[model samples]
Target: MKIRSVVLAAGLIGFSAVASASSFVGTTNAIGSILANTANALGDSTASTFGSDKVVLQAREDAASFVGSNGDLRGVNLEAALGHIRHQMPELQASDMQLAEAILAL
Candidate 1:
């Protein structure tokens, strides 16, 4: 009976960890979707108003707002985008907005 209780407790602990991980993944995915939608909107608005040439700059501004003051870049593969942006605009800072804009450009 003790062995059975121990096994059940262990199973519950494992299940709890899995649930926590799943929740984290779900939250990350939701945030990513919001960021992507915002980026797309910025790109489309820029293309319509100022033209495609200005989209990158507009994207940067919009992305900055999306990231807020904290500039959290979690759940996004922003490093790769940052590399590309750095190549194009060497003076741009390695901020969350710049990274988001880079992804938007692609």
Candidate 2:
């Protein structure tokens, strides 16, 4: 009877440890997921804001495609896009390169 009690106690202790470890792993995964989701949301918001302008939206596809194909920002499409952005949004404070890069990113 004493040996049976000892075996039962040991089994219960082992089960408890396993359960605790599983719970900890679950909590950690949940926190990681939350952090990943938050970062993705923030990135999406910034991208949307940057691309929201009609001028930027109009130029984005061409500029991005040119940059992707040419592997640089020295293309007619990119230049035209930059010029259009400048002419349309003169009040914008960003430089030509910055605008080109932004267009490429979009």
Candidate 3:
């Protein structure tokens, strides 16, 4: 087969595989709710800092909710996304709503 034909065939196979798979889905929650929950977890009303709680909360079954494979987006994306927010807009935290949409779209 010609190189072009082989590439076309592979593309078709990949497209079919992707189309056959179920789309991952999820919902969203308020960022305040999430942060408040984190605060509660830390046992400090005005701890005013995020660290282990953030990581723990992210992996939490309820906090940073999502669907599909456990490593679907990988920890890297989550970290990178948070970093982007820090440099681009510290005030803007990734809301569950946004995360849900992103998860579902994935």
Better of 1 and 3 by lDDT: 1
Model 2: lowest-lDDT 10 consecutive positions: 38-47
- How many clashes does each candidate structure show, in the order listed? 0, 0, 0
Positional deviation of residue 80's Cα in model 3 after best superposition, in angstroms: 1.3
Error of 3 at 37 (Å): 22
lDDT to native, each model: 0.57, 0.63, 0.44
User: For this target, which candidate reaches the highest TM-score against the unseen true structure?
Assistant: 1
Candidate 3 on 1-106: residue-level lDDT in tens? Answer: 6999999999999988776563321113454465445535433411233333344335334224343343344455455544543454466454543443332222
lDDT of 1 at 67: 57
- Best-fitting candidate, measured by lDDT? 2
User: What ranges in model 1 sit over 4 Å off?
Assistant: 47-69, 72-106
Off by over 4 Å in 2: 47-106
List model 2 lDDT by residue over 2-104, tens digit each.
9999999999999999999999999999976854564355335435655666655676666556545544445565566667666766676665544544654
Model 1 pairs whose backbones collide: none
The model with the greater lDDT, 1 or 2, is: 2
Which lDDT tens digits does candidate 1 get at residues 1-106? 9999999999999999999999999999998887677667644533443344343444544455445654553332344434445666676444556356534544
